[model samples]
Target: MSAWLFDLGNSRLKAAPLGEDGLPGDVLAFAHDGMALAAGWDSVLPPRIDAAHVASVAAPALRVALLDALAARAGRISLASTQPAWAGLRIAYAEPAKLGVDRFLTLLAARRRGGASLLVGVGTALTIDLVDAGGRHHGGRIAPSPTMMREALHARAAQLPAVGGGYRVFAADTGDALASGCLGAALALVGQSREAAVDACGGPVALLLHGGGAEALLPHLADAVHAPALVLEGLACWARPDGARR
Candidate 1:
């Protein structure tokens, strides 16, 4: 059976449908309003859908609203929580439930990637999750995207212009300088999180990176494998009882 995976974040809603083989068949990213059949939301969808799951970092009311919207279009819907699933991997957040669905789903997907992993979800907001070999999911860090970093700086201060574009390791000019500075900041945050995970677990942590921002964010992180379908893989894992590898 096919399954739908939704990573609902602040800026946009990322949805993908996975085929029986546990790989993404179709992908769609739309503005939050588009997905909502309600008043003001941009909605995007495939011609048809089967079962669907949502990992939402939205508020309770908003979550219920979005669930209601998806339920109208899809057959079955499951809302994932930070409360432990698949045995170990207890979410170690102060308010575990408040953890972003994308972050939690990334960790769930990381289960198959293997233990002692550094899970990174790069989108409008970037998140890093650390799962030890024993399946203990000690939480990681969160930061704005490279663009958002510049945007925040511009918003807070005055002179800095809102910057956008990919990162460069060796910036030669002004554009590259801005991109590299923002990129370096994001990489530093991700690297520090991975280093901390390695120190705590006393083993090398495998890196699994995904999300809309992956194209721009992956270059800066060292030795990170890009798995764009990680959320879909995790959704397939949740849908099927018999183990299937993606």
Candidate 2:
């Protein structure tokens, strides 16, 4: 059956076809405002699909817009939500519903790799989740991403440019300094999280990086696996008929 997977993040919408092997096909991404779909979005999806599985962490209005658009093309639609335990991966959140589905799905994908992992999603926010070899979540941390930090700073102090600057160890210019500080903070958090994960898991954990901003940090991470389509990969698993049970 022909199916599609959608991962609606805070600032972007990523969709891919689900192959027969239950993995995502080539992905298509579009950035959207919090309130509305981007122009020409309707023209991009396939003419029809048997199923549409969505994991959305975007604004409610954008989610509704996406669903409404998909309704015309999808025969069936499944929305992914956080669960306390699914497919052997147990959540650390006391209230599973409070956990973002993106993070949950990321953990699900990480667990499937069959080892301890530290998953970092660098998007509008920086999210770090750790799962052991046994598919047990040890919890996670969230913070503003480097891009968000820059935007926030620019908003408060107009002199700081929100977009242009290269990261440096010790920048002489204000823009580079801003970039260094923000990116450094995120890198430091990831480093600390990795150290904590190693202690908790009693060994080194595989570092899996994803999300729009992951590329920025990939060069700095030596052993990180960059899986930009991880959430979609998890959505493919979630869409499987016998995949995960509550």
Runs in model 2 lying further than 4 Å from the true structure: 243-246
Q: Find the candidate with the highest TM-score and give its number.
A: 2
- With a 3 Å backbone cut-off (N, CA, C), the pairs that clash in candidate 2 are none
Write model 1 residue lDDT over 67-111, tens digit each, in one string: 877777777888766554553456787677677656666676777
Model 2 residue 151 CA deviation (Å) reads 1.0
Per-residue accuracy of model 2 over 154-206 as CA lDDT, tens digit each: 99999889987788999999988998999999999999999999999999899
Distance (Å) between predicted and true CA of 186, model 2?
0.5
| Candidate 1 lDDT | 0.71
Worst 10 residues of 1 by lDDT: 33-42
Note each model's CA RMSD in angstroms: 4.1, 1.2
Q: CA lDDT, every prediction?
A: 0.71, 0.91
